[model samples]
Target: MAGSHGGSLKSWLAVIVILAGFTVGGVALCFGPNWPLVWAGAGIIAVGGVIALLVDIFSDVIVDAPRVLASEKVDRKG
Candidate 1:
């Protein structure tokens, strides 16, 4: 998967994590014995958010480096 299209697998996994977090969090918030379940859901969501951010950052860096380097080369040539 990683070799097929760069980091697509990680991105898809992150999305799955985010969706699961939202689903669990919403259900826990709606029906729970105590506040701990809600907090735990929030924590899951937070971790998903972090994973999402990291994936976005990594993808951006991977996508941008070649362009940046190419531009630098053009600048040097021009």
Candidate 2:
């Protein structure tokens, strides 16, 4: 039976990124004076959250690799 996590290492990395974005965004919203930086952090958090959500939902489809057949190999005459 296939386990829950069918995504690649990159997907996991994305999750990490999302967490970091949320953390940074929260901190910026709490402490940053400038509105632009706050908005940028919020945007980053939103984008990262969406990507992580998609990755988790479609992990299998996202990470599935095509099977290669031995007969598909081309032999070089060199």
Q: Which is the leading candidate under TM-score?
A: 1
Candidate 2: the clashing residue pairs are none
Model 1 lDDT at residue 38? 66
Least accurate 10 contiguous residues by lDDT in model 1: 60-69
- What are the clash counts of all predictions, listed in order? 0, 0
Which portions of model 2 miss their true places by more than 4 Å? 1-7, 32-34, 46-57, 61-78
Q: Whole-model lDDT for model 1 versus the true structure?
A: 0.67
Residue-level lDDT tens digits of model 1 in 26-53: 8877786447776776778788789889
Q: Write the per-residue lDDT of candidate 2 for residues 1-78, one digit (tens) a residue.
A: 133334576576666776777777677778856667667777777787787777673544443356676777678998
Show where candidate 1 strays beyond 4 Å: 1-7, 57-78
Looking at model 2, how many pairs of residues clash? 0
Q: Each model's RMSD to truth, in Å?
A: 9.1, 9.7
Quote the RMSD, in angstroms, for model 1: 9.1
State each model's CA lDDT, in order: 0.67, 0.67
